[model samples]
Target: MRIQEFLQHHGIATNPFADEDAQTDLVFKTACIRSVYHPAWDKIYGDPSEPATAVVFGEKGSGKTAIRLQIARHLADHNADHPQQQVFVVPYDDLNPFLDRFRERFSARRRRRPDRVLSQWHLWDHIDAILALAVTQLVDRLLGVRDARHPAARDEPLDCTMLDGSQKRDVLLLAVCYDQSTADNRLKRWQQLRRKLGVSVWMSYWDIAVGVAVTAIVLAAIALLGGWNWLLTVWPYVAIAAGWLPCGWRLLKWTWKAWQIARCTRTLRQTIPFLRRMLMRFPAGQLEGQPLPVRAATDDRYAMLDKLQGVLRTLGFAGIVVLVDRVDEPYLVNGSTDLMRALIWPMLDNKLLKHPGLGVKLLLPSDLERLLDREDRDF
Candidate 1:
């Protein structure tokens, strides 16, 4: 069927999972759906001043990610027009429970058919974490958020039957994505992300312990047979130990640093970007001309977002789309100003934003919208 006609049947709301872009606000994005911009959906949102930044704000079940996926798919099918446009940072790690979320959200949506999904639960709380980075992708190297090796990657949404077995549905992670505004409550819960982290930590520690234990066993056997001389002379056991110990130490250090990064990230993610004005000191430049220097901050949010945006942009090649799911959980729990300052405000009027051809869409919390409106009186 014709793309526009299909969109009409589905309604205008953006559907990251749908095949094409619908002209409406909740309209899906695809190459076939002509934008008022270019004949094709190629160039960066046409004029940045026009779209500025198109955010898909909502909680997890409000369908924000679904909308983003549809956009990505559209970009993939017609990337020829936007050879430079790409899906910079697909949250491949975040699709762990989409079907269940869809089911929950669909149920809630059936109840009221509200014009927007932000009223539901803290649907897009997770967006609070990733939106800034997504915004940075517009002019960065990772415009499309993929490696050069696979610039035109696209995954069609699972068949309806994928979620058909029971009253509620469940599905495995199929592809990377940017947001999760599909939940009924809109960017509300992020137990899935937290659960994923818990599983990752558990598995990583298990693997590390296993590796060390195996190495120790081998070393003990060497000692049993002879000593350091016998082991090192033949197996280089002493040298091996020397090399492995530092490697192991560094690995452990990095892992610990990563944990710290996660914790620090949750705490100061919002305020990081605003402090980026301090980038004057760092020796930073990208192979891609679209460059932003590293900045000094009492916090690492600025550095992290800058780096993530830069690297991912270069990888994306085409362009970048930021999908922020579950954006309200943090604000709902710990509403702080530094985060708002360091991260959110920086991107709101960021230099990266000044660059042409980028799209930063987020599914944020309704409470955040209210809070931000109150704080800045944007409302």
Candidate 2:
């Protein structure tokens, strides 16, 4: 029988492979296909921001990414209103092809999303990436739909270009620890955030940006303001200073903020004598901060989560269905194996992301579920 007739004859879904399946390709099919139908996906994972997310954990080759992908496909096909609902959980290795198709959707006037690459240790590694994205978020807040489709052109890129990963993460940590309203003057506030939070790295980057601008101005001025010979020696020094300026500024900015927070924490400790005495039994850092280098495999695991989340908030606002997958056990074990809560807390948070009209489901290994001591709300 012919392939199309064969597929039509069987009630089962078409062959899944892109190349091998003879339906699309054997390896995988575009998620935008129309064969998807659902009965109860609407009941369980249908409502995002509802209450608690459905989380499942599993080991390698456990069909975790697959199940989540299937559910994601269903959500996308059924809910056409919001096109950017997503499926994350593939490794960074697979992201290139995923993004290729996603971009095509944009040209087609449909919403799109690439799979989230779960790199090892990235959950901890994402401070820089998150901050970079946050800066873009600020830009989005300011510019709105004029720049909505092109995330690459905004502050996310500039944010990364200016700060090293470690420095960026420290800044993000401070942002989370503190909150403020940016309803107006987002650019001004976002710019001032580094100073308000005391992020030295931000200062360094800021100065670098200024120095580059100033050097450009100085060179332009040299044509009229002074002799070119002075410009030669001064230019190199200016360039060198301009070069280190951003790094130093970032270092200074974060250092200053860290200092202020430290002072505030210290003052609070001193004045609350009885409370301090009661809290003395608590461990100092493993709870508040667990450095990633100590646990080599514990970085950047969910580096893509914040990106996924930003898209969800956007989709939810637009009245679309957003499906997130491969998020169960979305954390990694780190160096301090001695303590358990560090790893447990993020896992707990991942499990709690459910809200109305939005769904994040997991196809996880049963063994992993046992290891984490959690139950899948859907399963």
Candidate 3:
């Protein structure tokens, strides 16, 4: 009997043991692998009401990615059922962009201890990027639902009225700044925001140039007015003050607004220092301008992380879960133990791990398990 005739006899449509299985997505293929699928599901995706943070470690072909996908699917389904109280999943699995940025930062560390330099690279940029993406997605969806410009939006089952005008503007500004597709205009808008928030206390080049031109014109007018009256020399002194007037007026306006925001958001006994500084520096005042702050590259990463968490809590998300996997992929690691140690150590901070309204599912390679075991203290 031919091979086709033998399979037809057994009522099989195709070869059951074909290598084509390797080409499929692991999440679907692992559905039949009860031993691997069931345990992972029970630990990570079993109960929606019970909050959980877990670390799954396995070798390259051991179905780690499959579990991540399954957890996402489970959460998505849960979200679909309970739209009002949804659990947002922020996937921090893509490591390329962050790794590239991290490499740059690592190279720039000048003659410092490797561990100390690693500590400085405190994962704030990565955390900020994640939350920004989440906030953008949520705000955009809400706006699209309410916008009558789109015919399909009318059918979305969300109560757009839940967000007031100020909150809406705050969210919109965040979306614009976080959007990568936004061009040079993004940086310009960001600078405009810093001025409005009183964070950019210094005068920009454009402001200085405009003021200078105004002062020059004023000096010429005055000199011509007294053309042979011997007043041209004194006009230079007057023009000097006039040049600074435009810049001063703009600074005064910004200062007043910043003071208003700082006064309104101030409170007492804050746990998160980042939130404390942020609330003190730029509070949610008018919400007319961008709500996010632009930090220098050397600022504290922990503060950035805490500030982002506070922002999410303020936005009314009950829980935010960050899924992190593929630790071995970053070029910085390249199978080097020391490099991997530097990369993942800061993520183990006690405060970050124990933060409220946050859960991190870290799926690491089995090779890293050995490094994790060498820890001197309990985590």
Candidate 4:
């Protein structure tokens, strides 16, 4: 007797337990995801209007991922019903890319030691990774860059015109700093996004213009006053070099800032030169007073989150829900309880989990729950 026949005989359409992973479970994805309820459903999927943090630790195959999928499905439905007050979902489950980049930051010996590599993981790294994921997805949707891998891409493209000038600047600034998509040309996509947002980046090239103008003036002056022979003089060369001072200075500043950001954001796979180029694409005025993840502390990340929330609010996302799961699945962790503890312990901070307009659901392995007893009251 085949499984389908057996299930049909029992009044069931399909085998609910056929697939062990919630992500691939057809029964759960199609039917049970909407109707089924875990006993702790309300706690994990809290009030979307006023999002709150919830931490759940379940053993392997205990439906943690199922709950995550359920929350996503429910949020999709909620957003469809209440278009104005939607919750932006950031899926932080895929950690391999991040872990790979993080490992590259360490020495070979340290990289071999998964425990030591994970020990270097901090809350700020998590924040950076989450921001990168969210910003990248938002950019994809806003620019209509469809990728089948991204669930949000299946929906209609976002209306970029909804954002006013300030809001557009916020989104572009966020994308400039945090959009980490390997598939697309970063600068090209950014330009597309800028055009979509109707934000002018003409001012961003002022340094180059200044350099060109100064050089042209010096050459024209030399040609008229001193003739072609003057071009061979050191004075003309000096004048030409001086012409590039503004552009060189600007490049140096952006390089230093990019180095700082790359150093601080360990989980992101960004080359300093690449980051500098991206920063150079933004107007100085737009980037001024903006919060970038250039510090090891969480303050800047929180500020950036606030900026992201503001942009999302204008796009009708009233709040943000961050789903963190599959900690033990990362190659660095590889199901090591100690490594998982090291990786996830930093994110348990109250300040981050309970931030205003943000709800972080940390679906962790039950093995790490034992370490909670060792934690102090503040944790």
Who wins the lDDT comparison?
Answer: 4
lDDT of 1 by residue, 1-379 (tens): 8767776788954444553323343433334233433223333234322323554334435544454554554555555454344444343223224322322434564524322322332212223234422432221221232332222343321112212221111111100112223222211222242232221223334434555766777778777877666653746555446546644664554444334332332312212221221111111221123212212232233333444444433433444444434333332223343332222443454444443444565445454465466564441
lDDT of 4 by residue, 192-235 (tens): 88888887777889988888988899878877786888867799
Considering lDDT, which of the candidate structures 2 and 4 is the better prediction for this target?
A: 4
Give the Å error, residue 346, model 3: 1.5
Off by over 4 Å in 4: 1-14, 148-154, 226-234
Candidate 1 ranges beyond 4 A from true positions: 1-44, 47-52, 55-74, 77-80, 84-152, 155-259, 265-316, 324-358, 362-379
Model 4: which residue pairs collide?
A: none
Best by TM-score: 4
Predicted candidate 3 versus true structure: per-residue lDDT over 1-379, tens digit per residue: 9888898999987656543323264436454433446454677664554445777888876767766766776676666676544566777776666555444444555424444444455445455556555644454444342432211112353343454444444443443334332223443434444443334323234557777887677768767786645353676666677778766765665555444432222111112332322222322244333333434331333443444444444444446777887777765555566766677776776666666667788878887789889778775
Model 3 pairs in collision: none
lDDT of 2: 0.36
**lDDT tens per residue, model 2, 334-373:** 1122122232233344423443332334444454455455
Q: What lDDT is obtained when candidate 1 is compared to the true structure?
A: 0.36
Taking all chains together, each candidate's TM-score versus the true structure is 0.34, 0.33, 0.61, 0.92
lDDT of 4: 0.85
Clashes of each: 102, 50, 0, 0
Assess the local accuracy of residue 11 in candidate 1 as a C-alpha lDDT between 0 and 100. 93
Which wins on lDDT, candidate 1 or candidate 3?
3
